[model samples]
Target: MKDGWSVFYITKNAWEEMLRDINNAQSSIYFEQYLFNDLEKGEIGKIFLEALINKAKEGVKVKLLIDSVGSTDFFFSSETVNLEEHGIDLRFHALSRKNILSNIFPNLYRDHRKVLVIDEKIGYIGGVVIGQKMEHWRDTQVRIENDFVPLLKNSFDAIWNSLEKTSARPHQYMNRHLNENAEGFLGNCPREKDKALRKEILSKISRSRKRVWITTPYFVPSRKMVRVIKKAARRNVDVR
Candidate 1:
């Protein structure tokens, strides 16, 4: 955290590995997810719940946040009471509001993050979540140590701190420094004037001189992203 990012890890079998990290945590633990499925979801969910409860009982200062809309199983469910009984600091984000405006656009605003940080030393970020529905889904889960971790910690803190705000702000985001190092976190913030991340990616793509590789199970690129990719291809930039 005090230094810059020095290590990076991309893991496919993330849940098992991350569970080990959580089990070994001696200090603090931060667990936030978009889909923290019910403990009955499967063994994965049950073990993680047990691990967090154990850590909290040991006074490890465990904090858990989940999206009320995304993690419908955990929000206002009896399982929430179980976690709270163990002294876990559990909170929900993007709680559904009872109004005409909220009902129409409920899908537009929801926390879609899956992150796990153990003792502030290791962090796991990706699309993976706990649930039987996601058991067979492919995702990119990264485990990293030191350097860039502080950035993630800060981002988590920001969202955690502003849990009550009804704005569509994001969690961890990437800047130039982070992008230049290796991978970058992308997020959209309504509070920002220029929709910063999109602009930054456009600028980066336009200035590419070597190669560009884009991969997604879902292909729904915006018009501007399509333009940049096409422009890069015209320049023989090895765009994919």
Candidate 2:
């Protein structure tokens, strides 16, 4: 973990670590999540809000991007106004309520990535989301301290800047700290129209030496992926 990353199976621990990093923020804080309406409505939410507001007041740049559908209530709340007033650059991704057409194409676009980058040397990517129910939910989040941190910020800026109406201040982060010898990192943005994640998964499965342990709550794989798994199983590879 000192060289690669630290993994958290419990979301509460991930959140506490995030808050600790936020408390020591020196330059910037960029955060994105799929569901966020209740982020500041619960008890832990209050602490996070206070910390973010305080950092903003201290001139630390803070930006947030949340999926609109999962956190629609947040858009109409006074907390939204309060956060904006406190100098937080808040934004909602892929508006599901744009019009009748948007409703018709519910699956066309959605931002389900949960990412956070603070300053220059720390980053987090995982499925953790803030809310009262999330405290008890078993999830995985990884805290990264490698060169990958800069790339994480770059990924955040991509969607953040696309929403021109949200006042996105896009800037390049110096990627001087990437983990060149580490495994590949991939991000799939709906706007990018790419199959990087699928391709990467297939490539890894094909190259796995001993075992492949995939523990997920939900999974709907493509026919090709199923075939690959079957082939691997036939070869005596532990395909669990």
List the candidates' TM-scores in order: 0.82, 0.87
Candidate 1 per-residue lDDT, tens place, 1-240, comes to 234322222322677788888989999999889887757645667778998999899899988988887778678679888998999988887544677575655445666778787888888777678776666566677777866676677667766776745644443333332435655455555444557667877889999999988655677889989999999999999987
List the candidate 2 regions with Cα displacement exceeding 4 Å: 39-42, 96-98, 101-103, 106-108, 165-184, 191-193
- lDDT (10s digit) by residue, model 2, range 1-240: 768699999989999999999999999999898877455545676677788899999999999887777666665678878999999999876555558675766545677889888996789999888776788789999999877787788778876776775454322222222356754357665444456677878988987778888988778988998888888888889989
**lDDT score, residue 231, model 1?**
94
TM-score of 1: 0.82
Give model 2's clash tally. 2
- Provide the lDDT at 219 for model 2: 86
Best by lDDT: 2
